[model samples]
Structures are given as structure tokens and as C-alpha cells.
Target chain A: MKKNITPYLFAAPAFLVLGYFSILPMLQTAYYSTLEYSFFGPHRFIGAANYVRLFTDPHFWATLLNSLLFLSVTPVLMVVSLTLALSVRNLLRGARIVRLMLFLPVVTPVVIAGIVWRWIFTEETGLLNHLLSLASVGPVRWLTEFPTNLVSAMLVTVWRGMGYYMMLFLAGLALVPREVEEAGILDGATPLQQVWHVLLPLLRPTLLFVAVVSSSAAVKVFTEQYILIPGAPLDNKALVSFLYRHAFERFDFGYGSAAGMVLFGMTLLFSYTQVRLMDREQSS
Target chain B: MRKALSRIVIITASAAAVIPFLWLAATSVKGAEELFVYPPTFIPRTFQWENYTGVWNAIPFGLYLVNSLTVALLSVVFNLLLSSLAGFALARYRFRYRGLLFGAVLFSMMVPKEMLVIPLFTSVLRLHLADSLLGVVLPFAVEGMGIFLMRQAFLALPRDVEEAAVMDGAAPLRLWWSVMLPMVRPSLAALAIFTFIGSWGDFLWPMVVLKSQEHYTVQVGLSMMLGTFVDNYRYVAAGSLLALLPVALLFILMQRHFERGLLSGSGK
Candidate 1:
């Protein structure tokens, strides 16, 4: 009993803090989602009216579509970065520095990355446009167009995140026992054949982690869209960005909470399904 | 040879990776006239070192730097202390709901922070803690990732050492501070570096909570610089460079530990 109490005492501070800041707030959001509460409030319980309104709202659907579009980019990034990792996995020299370079963007703030890329993709005096002009391709209004803005945001997201995923892939690659690879090679298998037949199978867990994390991150990407193209031409708002505007800007707290709940539900479901599948894969 | 070709590939890949940052740094030094050249100046003719000074003076950057450092340090200290305690419990103790508590922590990790922004803001507002440093730091202090990392690190330690400490009449706190913590120094260092970099780079939370100019973080200040009509590209670039410098240095200084932390955290 004393021993059990001691552990609870040790864990108390952290749980209390998490409870206050994270758990309590989450509950509060759920409560507020059912009520017509704003910052300036004469509040009344509305019993899922906000959610009902949220479903019918055009902007909500647009935001959901934008989130879907944002999510599609993650698999492409994962494949690219993982491929890069696989390509360089066997290289002996300077792999560390290359890995470092890939992970550099992960440390840089998302807003800063968005700002810098905004400059790169700027229409008139942008570096990308200037480069494109030499090839007579485009002065693309990247941050202005409907799907283009989303694409532009996705491009920056991929560029910034690829390195981090690459590092993860590198770690996964390292875990692929060298002896196993050597055995495959000795058995008259080519390098590609060894990787395909032996290494990729061993990397299942890491691949699943990357897929789940990148997908979750894709869903929650607010800083890029918020910083680069806030309400860009009416049709380019990401879900989280729209949620931000609703909650903070318009003071529509209840509606925003409903959106938050939806996002939470979607992320939870996706993560659950991924983890379960991965665990099943591991067990089998 | 394959070796030579691989070397070329690495060099090219690294170059592609680094070019944008190099461009950002170079553009920071170019004069306004050279910035918009037809053929963009890869190298600035006259390095306008004043752009650094200019951006520094343009905003309350000195104050902003202090605010950022203060918030990040507080967050680091809070996270280190609270997470270490939680990790010790989770690792060492066999409580009734240990699995449940651990599950809660894991669940917190999956919940998107953006989803909680509305309720968090309302809570902070209700507490009348909005636009304050404490408000900004408090919420971020209890990170699930830090707790999870520390718990994993602690669990990896041999139980005999801790048992020996207890047999030698060392209390739980003493055992933790002296024996267990020192054993997990690398993990703690890794957590510190991760938390420091994360807090330093945080923008949205600071932007939401910090209303006063005096309390603005570096990211917020930089964003404000962009919002203002002052179209000084050099200054903006310089500010961006300065904002990035500390984190870059932090990464370089703790590269090994950072890599280890990333590997462990990603469950690789």
C-alpha cells in the first residue's frame, strides 16, 4: 500500500498539470460544443446544434475537402523520403551529414518555413517564378488560386517534413540487421533484390509509425496555411486554419469546438485503425 | 566506380537540401537594389551588415529575445521536473491503474493540439491569464512526449541498481535524483534539447495568448515585421536568419543526442 501510494505521489504533479491544461480543456471544449457559448456569452445549452449547423455549412465542407487534399500529400512525401533513406542506407561515407541536412527543416519553425517559402513562391518577384520564366512556364499565382494554394502549401510541407521522415527511415534502415542483408546477397541475390525481399519486410513497424505520424501532422497543419495564405481567395482555407478563424477571429467558440471535435474524432479513428493494423501485422 | 557515383549523389543531394538556406542567408546581406535583380545575385556585391542592426532596431527585438528565452527556459525546467517525476512513477511503480494512466498519456500524444486550441483559449481566458507569459508557458509545460520519452528511458534501466539504492536507505526522491536520473542523463539531455528547440520555435500558442508587444516571442515579432508595411527584404531576411540561428546552433551542438531522441521517440 505504501509503495503504491509513493508512486502515485510521484506521478501526481504531472497528471495534475496535464489534467488542468490538456484534459480539463478538452472536456471544456466538449461541454462548450453542446452550448451556445462565445467569449462574450449569455450562454445556453444548444444540444448539438452547433454540430448540426457545422455539417450543413459550406465552409465546413470546403475545410474538410482542404484537409483531405492536405492529407494526400503525406503518402507522397513518405514514399520520397523513405526512398531517399533506402537509397543511402548502405552508403558508408558522409551519410550522417546527408541525414543531418535532411532533418534541418524539422527544427526550423513551421511559420518561418511558411514565410520563407511564401517569398520563394511569390508571383511577381518570386524566385520560383523567376526560374520558371527562363523556361517560359509560369508566374503561377501560387498563394491565390483555389487548389494551387493548397498545392503550394503542400509543397512547402513536403520540403520541410521530408528530412524528418528520412531520418526515421534511416533509423529503421539501421535496424535491418546487416547480417540478414549479407545472407541474402550471398544467396545470389542482387542489392535491390535483397532490400526488396529482406529489408523492406523488416521495416514494417517504422513505415507504419511514419505513415500514422505524417497523416496526423497533415491533419493538424495550421501554421503553414495560417501564415502563408490566410483565407486565400475564399477557396483555400485548410480546416485547422478555418477553425482558428472561427474560434479566435469571429468568436464563434461553440462552432469551432464542434469542428475541433470532428478533427479529433477523425484523427483518433485514423490513428487507431493504423496502430491496430500495424500491431496485427507485427503479431502475424 | 559505384563509390564515386554514390559520393556525387550525396554531394548533389546535400547541395539541393542546403541551397534554400544559403540563399536566405545571402539575400539577407544584399542591398535593396541587388535583391530584385533580373539575374538574381547568388552573391551580394556589398554585404549590408546594417540589415542585421536595422532589424534589431526595427522591433523591440531585444525584449522579444528575452521573452522567448524566458518562456523556453521555464518550459524546459517545468517539463524536466514534472516529466522526470511522472517517468519515475510510471517506470518504477506497479499501481492499480498504471496501464490506464499510461494509456491516457499515449492518448494525449495522438490528440491534435489544434483541436484543443479553442477550449484551451477559453480556459486561459476564464482564468484571466491571457496575454501573460505564465499563460503561454503553463499549457506547454506538461508535454506528453517528454513524459513518454523519460518513462521509456527509465524503464530501460536495470532494477537492481534502484533496489540497491533503496536498500542503502536512499529515499525515493534521493534515489531518483542521484541514481536513476544520472543513469538516464543522455535521455534527459536529449529531452532538454528537444523541448528547448520546440519551445523556441513555437508560434501559434504565443500568438494566441501573448497580446502585449512586450511579451511577443521571436516568431510573433518576425510575423509582425512581415505584417508592417516596411518592405525591407534585407531586414526581414536578417531577422529570419537570427530567429533560425539559435535553433540551428542547438541542433549542431546536440546533433547526436537529437538523433538518438528522434530514433527512440519515433519507436525505431
Candidate 2:
């Protein structure tokens, strides 16, 4: 009895804090998502009206499509980083320095990254446009345009993220036994064949983990859009930014919560499906 | 031949990875005229070192720095002590609902942070703690990643040491402090490094909860440097360089621990 009491006492502080801050708030979100409330006054029970409104809204659908578009870049980043990792895995010297350089941006704040990239994407005096001019191309309004804004955001995401994913892939590569490679090489297998047939199979678990994390990150991407391109620019649109303007700027907490809940649901569904699919692949 | 090709690939990839950061630093020094040159100046003709001073004067960056440091440091101390205790319990003791509690902790990791922000903001406001450093630090003090890392570290330890301490009439608290804690130094260091990095880099929650400019974190303060499309890009860049200093230093000083922390925290 004393022994059990001691353990609980030890764990109580953290659990209490986390419970009050994390669990309780989550419960409140679930509760409030069911109600119609605002900062100004009297609240009313609305059952699933918020969710109903969310599904019916075209903007919600647009944001959902935007999120999907944002997510498409993760695979491109994954392939690029994996290839980079594979290319650099064998270096006996300067590899650690190379790895460190790649991972530096991951450690830097996303806000800073967003701001810096915004400067680079600026229309007239931006670094990207300035460089492009040297190639005889006209200046492009990267952030001021719709699809271009999304593309610019994706570029920043890829640049900031690829190194971190490369490190993870490097870790995965480290775990691959050398004898498998040696055997493949002895059998006159090409390097690509060896990687395809031997290394990739062993890397399945790591691939799945990266896929889920990166995908979830892609969906919740707000800082980049918010900092780089604040508004739709008379033609462009950002789903999360639009949601932010509605919630905080306009004080539409109920609507914002509804949007957040939808985003959360989509993220969970996507990540869960990916995890399960990967699990099935591993077992098979 | 393969090795030569690998070298070329690595060089090209590394160049692509690092060029943006280099350009940022270079552009920070370039004059307004040089910035918009037809052919971009990779090197600035005149270094504008005053951009740092200008940026510092433009905002209450000093206050923001203090606010961010205090909140982050306090949060780190709280997390290290609380998480180590919880992690020790989870690792060493058998209690009713032990699995349930551990499972709950793991399950919390899956819930996207965006889902919680609305409720969290409401709760903080209800408690009348909004727009304060306490509001910022309190919620973050109990971290899932820290506990997870510490728990894994504790599990990897030898049981014989604790059993011997028990035979020596050492209380659990004494054993934890004097024996177990010392053994998990690497894990503790890892947690500290990661926690500090996360706290320092965090922007979204601070943006939501902190209303007063006095309580703004460095990230938020930096954002204030850009107002209504009338930004001084050089100053903002200089401020960003300043803001990045601590995190970069922390990473370099504790690179090993940072790597371990990231690996364990991410379950990679």
C-alpha cells in the first residue's frame, strides 16, 4: 500500500498539470465544438451545427483542397532527402559536418524561416526574382499570386524540412546491415538494384514514421502562410490563414473551432490510414 | 567512380541546402540599392552593421528577450523536475492503472496541437491568466516528449542498483536523487536541450495567449518588426540573426544530446 502510494505521489504533479492544461482543454474543445458561443454574449446549444456549417461551406472545401495540395510536396521532399541521405551515407569524412549543415534550419524557428523566405520571394527586390533576372526571366510575384503563393510556401517547407528528414533516413541507413550490401555487390548487382531490393525493404518502418509526421506537419502549416502572404490578394486564398482571420481577427471562435476540428479530423484520418497501411506492409 | 559521383551529389545537395542561409546573411549587409541590383550581389559592397542597432531600437526586443528567456527557463526547470519524477514512477513502480496512464501519455502525442489551441485559450482566459508569462509557461511545463524520453532512459537502467540502494535503507526519493538521477544524466541533458529549443522556437501559442507587447517572445517581437508592409528588411534580418544566436549556440554546445533527444523524442 505504501509502495503504491509513493509511486502515485511521485507521478501526481506532472499528471495534475498535464490533466488540467491538456486533457481538460481537449474536453472543453470537444464540448464547445458542440455549442454556439461567441466572445460577445449569450451562448446556446447547437449540437452539430458547427460541423454541419463546416461541411456546407465552400471555403471549408477550398481549404481542404488547399491542405491536400500542400500535402503533395511532402512526398517530393521525402524522395529528395532520402536520395540525398543515400548519396552521402558512405562518406567517411566531412559527413557529420554535412549532416549538421542540413539540420541547422530545422532547429531555427519557423517564424524566422517564414520571414526570411518571404523576403526572398518578394516581387521586386526579392532574392529569388533578382537571381531569376540574371537568367533573363521577368520578375515574378511569388507570394502575390494564388498558386504561386502555395508553391512558394511549399518551397520553404521543403528547404526547411528536407535536412531533418535526411537525418532520419541517415539513421535508417545506419541500421541496414553491411553484409546485405556486400552480398548484393558480390552478385554484380548495380547500386540502384542493391538499394531497391535490399536497403528499401529494411527501411519500411522509418519511411512510414516519416510519412505520418511530415504529412501531419503539411496539413497544419499556418505560420508560413500567415507570415508570407497574409491575405488572398484579390485572387489567391489560404485556408488556414482564412480560418485565422475569421477566428482571431473577426472573433468567430465557434467558426474557427469548427475549422480547427475539421483540420484535426482530417490530419488524424490521414495519419492513421498511413500508419495502418504501413503496418500491413511490414507484416506482409 | 561511384565514390566520385557520390561526392558530386553530396556537394550539390549541401550547396542547395546552405545557399539560402548564406543569401540571408549577405542580403542583411547589402544596401537598398545593392539589394535590387539587376544581377544580385552575392557579396555586399558596404556592410550595414547598424541594422542590428536599428532593429533593436525599433521594437521592445530587450523586454521580449527577457520575457522569452524567463518563461523558457522556468518551463525547462519545471519540466525537468516534474518529468523526471513521473518518468521514474512510470519506469520503476507498479501501480494500478499504470499501463492506462502511460497509454494516455502516448495517446496525447497523436492529438494535433491545433485541436487543443481553442480550448486551451478559452481555459487560460477563464482562469484570468491570459497575457501573462505564467500562462505561457504553465501549459508547456509538462511535456509529453520529455517524459517519454526520460521513461525510456529509466527503463534501460539496471534494476540491481536500485535494489541495492533499497537494502542500504535509502528511501525512494533519496535513491532517485542520489543514485538514479545521476545515472540518467545523458537523458536529462537530452530533455533539457530539446525542451529549451522547443520553448525558444515556439511562436503560435505565444501569439495567441500573449496580448501585451511586454510579454511577447522573441519570435513575436520579431514579427512586430514588420508592420503593415512597411518593413525594414535589413533590420528584420539582423534581428533574426540575433534571435537565432541562442538556439544555434545551444545546438552546437550540446549537439550530441540534441541528436539523442531528437532521435528518442521522435521515436526514430
Candidate 3:
């Protein structure tokens, strides 16, 4: 009995903290979504009113559409990061330094990186425009403009993610049996063919992992958009940023909680798929 | 030709990865007039080391730095202690509901942090931890990833060692402290550094809770600074580089552990 109790005691702190901070809040987020609450007023039972408002709200739809658009960047991220991983895989020298350089952006805080990228994307006196001016091109506004603003913000996401997904790909690459590659060579497969036929099937798990994680992150993107273009119009904000604006900035907690529930649902779907895939892999 | 092409690709990619640092460093030193030049020079003609000093004084940058360091260090300490305790229990004990408890940890891992913010802020306020560094550290103190990583490490330990320790009449806590903890030192190191980095770089939660300028972390401080010092990019650049210094140093020192941690954290 003492021994059984000892294990419980050892685990109690962790469960306590996680229960209060993580599990409890998750339930509260669900509960709060059903109420009419704000800084100006007390909590009132609104029942489905917040969700109804969320569904009818044009800003909510636009923000959700923007999140889906952001999710489209995952394929670009996968290709770029996988290419980066492949490019460096065979290098016998300087690979470590290359990796360190590439991973620097990942290590930099999003606010700092967003600030640097913001300066770079400035229409005039920015390094990017300065480079384009050498070819006598008109300086294009990168951040404030409609589509370019979202595109530039997405570029930052891609930039920070490159080294991260590359590392994941490299880890997956390390697990592939070497004799399989040799067999492909004996079959007279070119490098690209070897990749397509030999390597990709093995990398399906990693690709799925990257796809799920990056897409979920894209849906939850807030800092990059917030920092890059501080007052970006309604169409430009990601779903999380919209939630943030309503909840914190405007003190509309119910509205924000409803948006949060939607974001949570989307992320939960991705995470569930990832868990299923991982479990399948383990069982096999 | 193949090698050369790959080299060019590698080199261009490396430059793309690194040039931002060089550009940021160069910009941090340039005079205000030089910043407006049609083609910004790669090298600053005059060194403005004073910008670092200026930005340091512009806001309570020193206070923010201290707050960030304290919060990160506290997070590392708490995460190591709590996660390892929980991990050891899960790995060694044959308690009922062990699988259920572990499943709960995994489920919590899947909960996106964005969903937790509003509710967490409310929780923090209820606990009277709002506007404090503890507010930033409490939710992340025992991360699911840390618990999972430590559990894996403990499970990998040879069973004979624990049996030997038990034969010596050592209590469970003694066995954990003297035998088990040292065995999983590498995992602890990885969790420590990762937790420190995560806490240090955290922006959104800190931004939400830390209302006073005195309590802000460097990330929160920098975001606010960006709005006030809109015209002075040099100061902001200097402040950013200064904030980045410790993390860069830690990464260089612990790159191997970081790489290993990254792969393991992803369950690869």
C-alpha cells in the first residue's frame, strides 16, 4: 500500500499543475465559448449565441479563409526543407556549419525575426528593394500591400521552418536502410529516381509529420502576422490573431473563446491524424 | 559539374541562412543618414556601438533581460525536478491507471497553446499570478514533452542497476536521487536547455500576462519597443542582437544536444 501510494505522490505535482493549468483551462475555454463575457460586462449565459455570431461574422469567415490560405504554404515548406536536407546529406565537410546557420532563424524568437523581416520588407531603404532597384525595378511595398503583405508574412513562416523540417527529414533519412539505396543504384536509378522510388516511400512518415505539424502551426499563426504588419486589415489576420484581437485587444472574451474553439477543433483534427499515423507506425 | 552545382546550391543556401545576421549586425551600427541611402551598404562605414548603449537605456532593457533570465532559469529548474519525478514513477511503477495517466499526458501534448491563452490568462488571474514572472513559468513548468522524454530515458536504463540499488536498502526516493537521476543526466540536460530556450523566447503568453513594463521579458519588451522606436531601426536592431546573444551562445555550445533533443522531441 505504501509503495502504491509513493508512486502516486511522486506523480501528483505534475498531474496537479497540468490539470489546473492545461486541462482546466481547456474546459474553461469550452465553457467560456458559451457565454457573453467581456471586460465591460460580467459573464452571462448566452448559450450558442457566440457561436451563432461567429458563424455569421464576415470577419470570422475571412480570418478562417486566411488560415486555410496560410495552410497552403505547407507544401512549399516541405519541398524547400526536403531539398535542403537532401542537398546537405552527402556533404562530408561544412555540413555542421551550414546546419547551424540554417537553424539560426529557428532559434531566433519570432518577434525578433519578425522585426528583422519587417525591416527587410520595407518598401524603401530595405535591402530587398535595394537589390531590386539594381535591375531598375520599381520598389514594391511588401508588407502594407494586400496580397504581398500576407505573402511576405508567409515567407517568414517558411524561412523559420526550413531548418526545422530539414532536421526532421534528415532524421527520417538516417533510418532508411543503406542496402535499399545500393539496390536502387544497381538497378540503374538516377538520383532523382532513387529519391522518388526508393527514398520517398520511407519518408512518408516524416512528410506526414511535417505536414500535420506545419499546417496546424500555420492555422495558429499569430506572432508573425501581428509583428510583421501590426495593423494589418481584417482580411490579413490569421484566425489566432483574430481571436487575440477580440479577446485581449477588444476585451470580447466570449467572441474570442468561440474563435478559439474553432481553432482548437481544426488543430485537434490534425493532431488526431498525426497520433493515428504514429500509432500505426509503432504497431507495424 | 554535379559537385559544383551542389556546392553553389549549398553555398547560396548557406548565405541566405546567414546573411540576415550580417545585415542585422551591419544595420545596428549604421548612422541614421546612412540607413536612407539608395543602396544600403553591406558594411557600416562608421561603427555606432553607442546604439547598443542607447537601446539599453531607451527602455528598461536591463530589467527585462533580468526578468527573462530569472523566468527561464526557474522554468528549467522546475521542469527538471517535476518531469523527472513523474517520469521515474511512470517508468518503474506498475500502478493501476498507469497507461491511462500516460495517455492523458499525450493528449495534453496535442492541445495547441493558442487555444489555451484566454482561459489560461483567466486562470492566472484567479491564482493572483498575473503580472508576475511566475505567471509565465507556471503553465510550462512541467511540459508534456519533458515528462515523455525523461520517461523514455528512464525506461532505457538497465534494470540491474535499479535492482542493485534496491538491494542496498535504499528507499525509492534515494534510488531515484542517487541512482536514477545521474543515469538520465543527458535527458535532463536536453530538457533543461530546451525548456530554458522555450521560456526565454516565449512571447504571446508573456505579452498577455505581463502588463507592467518592469515585468516584461525581452521578447515582450522588444515588441513594445518596436512601436515606440518606429523611426530608429538601429536601436531596435541593436536591442534584438543583444537579446539574441545568450541564446546564440547556448546553441553553439550545445548544438549536439539540441539536435538530439529535436529528433527525440518529435519522437523520431
DockQ top scorer? 3
Comparing 2 with 3 on TM-score, the higher-scoring candidate is 3
Please, what are the lDDT tens digits per residue for candidate 2 over residues B1-268?
Answer: 8888788878887776777788778867766667666556778899988777776787777788788789879888999999999999999999997887776666566566776777778778988989998988888788665676677778879879899999999998999999999999988888887788889988878888999888899888877666632546777777788888888888877777777666664444
lDDT of 2 by residue, A95-146 (tens): 7788878778888888888888887887887778987888988688798877
The deviation in Å at residue B224 for candidate 2 is: 1.9
The TM-score obtained by model 2 is: 0.94
Where is model 1 more than 4 Å wrong at Cα? A1-4, A186-193, A273-284, B1-9
Question: Which is the winner by DockQ between candidate 2 and candidate 3?
Answer: 3
Model 3, stretches more than 4 Å misplaced?
A1-3, A136-138, A276-284
Candidate 3 structure quality by residue, lDDT tens digits, A1-284: 45468788889999888888888888898999999989678899999999999999999999998898899789999998898888888899989999999898888888888988888888878888888888998587888887788888898998888999999999999999999999999999988899999999999889999999898889888899889999779778789988988999998888899999999898887887666665444334
Task: Give the runs in model 2 whose Cα sits over 4 Å from its true position.
Answer: A1-3, A233-239, A269-284, B228-231
Fnat scores for every prediction? 0.56, 0.57, 0.63
User: Which scores higher on lDDT, 1 or 3?
Assistant: 3
Q: What is candidate 3's CA lDDT for residue A236?
A: 81
Clashing pairs in 2: none
Q: How high is the DockQ of candidate 3?
A: 0.69
Clashing residue pairs for model 1:
none
